[model samples]
Target: MIFTVQIKVMPLKDLLDPQGKAVMGGLQNLGLNNVSDVRIGKHIDLQIEAENREAAIATAEEAAKKLLANPVMEVYEITVS
Candidate 1:
């Protein structure tokens, strides 16, 4: 069976996101004052071959941990369908 997987990778809350800050500053300069903050992240989509949803999720978890997300400064969430 094949599963569709979605992965969201983001900077840790306690960490400083320079890219996000830069975007926020740009937004403020553009007169978009209503937006208080901004954060940048990554979205990864994968087509995984597995026997079941659980198996697909596990594969995604390992991939996220090993390569996709940096555990020191980033966190990742995985969804399988």
Candidate 2:
């Protein structure tokens, strides 16, 4: 079976996100001061071949851990469909 996987990769909370900060600054410059603690992350959508939903989830998790996300600085969450 083929499964669709959605992965969200984000910088760890304790880590500083300069890109997010820059964007936040831009937003503020645009008079959007209500936004705070902005964070930027990547969304990855991919399809994998697996026998079952569990297997698909496992594969997506492994892919996220091993390649898509930096375990030290970033964390990843996976959704399978």
Off by over 4 Å in 1: none
Question: Against the unseen true structure, what C-alpha lDDT does each candidate score?
Answer: 0.94, 0.95
- Tens digits of per-residue lDDT for model 1, 42-76: 99999999999999999999999999999999999
Lowest summed lDDT across 10 adjacent residues in model 2 is found at 72-81
Error of 2 at 43 (Å): 0.6
In order, how many clashes per candidate?
Answer: 0, 0
Q: What is candidate 1's local distance difference test score?
A: 0.94
State TM-scores per candidate.
0.95, 0.95
